[model samples]
Target: MSKGISGGCKCGAVRYRGELSDISSFRCYCRDCQQLTGTGHSEMFPLVAETFQLEGPSREYQMAGGSGQPTWSSFCSTCGSPLTRRSERMEHCLYVHASSLDEPEKHKPSRILYADAAQPWDKPNLDE
Candidate 1:
């Protein structure tokens, strides 16, 4: 197993930890991610649900994915910091915002998702 990581929300109302063995990270440019983050994309790292744990007050929001599956997002109710996201369609795994990790650099996305949805001006230098 890989070393564990921990992080919490801006207001300290929510916290999470995971003993990560593996992480599949991605940068998502889907409309849902764009609007939710108010940015061109959102970075995420998926972890096995069984190895993740959380504490403190959090609120959950549910929305339909492009695939018509329900996705649930959890955040700190007090500070509105995005914490975790999961989908019934992706059973057995929970996704954590890459930036929410204590050491964000540890989770570098391997690929981009919904790249077609990316705004032209927001595109990064892929050649790098």
Candidate 2:
């Protein structure tokens, strides 16, 4: 029963709301995340999939995940803002981009994933 959270795309064309899940937030340095965010990694937070609701114009792109399962990246069709990542391997939670939250500061990444795939220029902050 965590507090509810809400957010949307850059252009306000897409919006989502959900109750936070008990799952710890995480930072992912996987190549998919790197390419998606155009950064060293992506900040992600989990929401209870059963409580999640989305609205407005959005699109999704599917790709093979590190687990070799189908993963989908959702974005705002109008503003092209990255919104969420869903994997067939993890269906109970909807992973939302931390930056996409209405209060991005609320996101606190507790662990790092795919650190081995980190780039030299943007190494994972192990100290955090």
Candidate 3:
């Protein structure tokens, strides 16, 4: 059996597990990500939606994406730790915040999204 990736929220109110997807992990610098993470960008890793499992108290916040599609941010209702991001544009996969992973060091972002929207102080290392 394949080992599942697992992690949870800060307050232990939310947890999730899933099998990794073929989609490459990426860093998003969009305004929504910045505001959600309270930083310049967000690191995301993808998991197969069909294999994703989430438990405990969580809430979702929806907003219009840069693509003008509805996007949702799921987080722990107790600790408010951002957990995942979902969008109408890509429903086949679940994008998890890399920092929310049990092994965040395993996250390797291969690409950058919304680089043009990236802040000056947090310039993306495009050469990666």
Candidate 4:
């Protein structure tokens, strides 16, 4: 059986619940991802947009992605926890941050994106 994902912001101001099928998860090493996540890469599961839902208010920011399409990042304004991301490049999908999920421990990225942009000191052990 597939696991369901449900979570909220650090302050419980933004809640979401969803089920992802045909899973295609990855970690992005683009500079924008690094700056937004404050880490080497941003781990996300790209799910069908229709499968995701959000409750409560969130602040959204948009910028061009590596694909040169507008990408939106939404987060809770109250606690500043990153929530969801969507890109015009993948119109049918929503990229959910693994760190925002209640079952974060279960998240396993299957691939890495923008590998050439990766930081020298931070790299995922692909062997695992």
Candidate 5:
């Protein structure tokens, strides 16, 4: 059986539901990710196009990434919780923060990206 993912803003003003397949998760340690996640790494799950859908309007901001690609960061305008990131090269895909899932335990990062961009002080524990 395939169960979909459901989550929303802390204030419940924004809700989302989607069915994502071919899951691929990773932690990115680029400057943008560190700043956005407020941590050493930003965890995400690769989202296949057409598999994800937005139920309500989400606030989006344009930013630059380590990949030198235009990044669009989106979040709940009401609560300001980070929602997703869309990149130009990955237009067919959307990346959602794993922590944003209703059941975060079910989503785990599988790899690390931009390892060269990682700061000297940020050491992520990869062993589970």
Candidate 6:
């Protein structure tokens, strides 16, 4: 198993610790992510739904997603920083922003998703 990883909400109000899953991470250029983050693309770090544990209750907001469905977004109510995103489909697994992890640097992007939605000006630095 890989070394354990940790991280928390932006306001430091909530925290999490767990074994880093072997799942691959990616940069998403979907409209949902671009609008939520005000960027051309957003980062995703997916893992087994049960591998993560939240130390505190998270504040969430449901908004109209790109698919014209209700999407759930959570954050630290105090810090107002993005934390996680959940699909309207109850069966789908949850997705957490890799940046919200306690150790963001520990993550490495494996690829890009929703390339069809990529912005014209958001040239990514492949070296970063």
Q: lDDT of each structure?
A: 0.81, 0.91, 0.91, 0.83, 0.78, 0.72
Q: Which is the winner by lDDT between candidate 2 and candidate 4? A: 2
Q: Per-residue alpha-carbon lDDT of model 1 for 56-110, expressed as tens digits?
A: 9999999998889999988899898888889998878888887788888677677
Top candidate, metric TM-score = 2
Give the per-residue lDDT of model 5 (tens digit) for 11-34: 777776677657567888878888
**What's the lDDT for candidate 3?**
0.91
Q: What residue pairs are clashing in model 4?
A: none
lDDT of 2 by residue, 21-116 (tens): 888889999999999888889999999899999999999999999889999999999989999998888899989999999999767789999999
lDDT of 4 by residue, 15-59 (tens): 998777575788889899888888898989766788788998899
**Of candidates 2 and 1, the better by lDDT:** 2
Candidate numbers, best TM-score first, in rank order: 2, 3, 4, 1, 5, 6
User: What TM-score does candidate 2 reach?
Assistant: 0.94
What does the lDDT come to for candidate 4? 0.83
Give the Å error, residue 52, model 5.
Answer: 1.7
lDDT (tens digit, per residue) of candidate 6 on 1-128: 35566677766888866564465678888887887777788887665456667777678788877667887877776776677777665323456788888778777788887887888897654456
What is residue 116's positional error in candidate 5, in angstroms?
Answer: 2.8
Regions of model 3 farther than 4 Å from truth: 1-3, 126-128
TM-score of 5: 0.86
Global lDDT for candidate 6?
Answer: 0.72
